[model samples]
Target: MQFLYGVQLLIMILMPLIQMVMKAIGIGFVSYLGSNLIIDQAMNYIVSQMSGAGAVVQQILGLAKIDVAINIYFSAITTRMVLSGLNKLQDRKRAQVWRAPGGTSIEA
Candidate 1:
């Protein structure tokens, strides 16, 4: 029990650091993608090819003569990546708890 507590304490201490590193990586990735002209053009082409709400959004921005910054798209992608990472981390914790010795399995 003491060993388990120690491990838990260590994880608690490291979690924030892990999240901070992830955020930093996400920001760096977005910046890199935004700064590359080829990637930027590719992304614009992809967005323009998109249908439904994407089309409407593109039309709106075009009509308004607003050149949406690349950061807008990249920031959204970064946010999604971070959220997905957090969800996976939580899922792993839940799996550990559910699969621990003598722990009851949850059925869907």
Candidate 2:
């Protein structure tokens, strides 16, 4: 249980950091391309639009990352809870069943 929670927490923390790094890398690539590749008016307009579009994309990616983290956290918690409940029920079932010393069923 502790290990599971620890992993989940670690993943949640790392997700945003990863997202930020990826966004930075993408922005860097775009800026490098924009500076090196501009040729004419149309190209200039396109590069400017790309810069603006990158901002919008970064925001969308951030929101998407958040959504993915939330879904993962919820899924992990819900799955653990459901599986633990099933295990408890199974234990109860085993306890209720009569068994002989040799592991044979004992008819009541």
Winning candidate number (lDDT): 1
Q: What lDDT tens digits, residue by residue, belong to model 1 across residues 12-87?
A: 9999999999999998788567656555676777665643357678788677655456557666766776688689
lDDT of 2 by residue, 19-70 (tens): 9999989976885576445334444564466456677785885676854664
Clashing pairs in 2: none
Worst 10 residues of 1 by lDDT: 94-103
RMSD of each: 12.1, 21.0
Tell me the TM-score of each prediction against the true structure: 0.35, 0.34
Each model's lDDT comes to 0.71, 0.68
Per model, state how many residue pairs clash. 0, 0
In terms of TM-score, the best-performing candidate is: 1
Q: Residue 16 of model 2: what lDDT?
A: 100
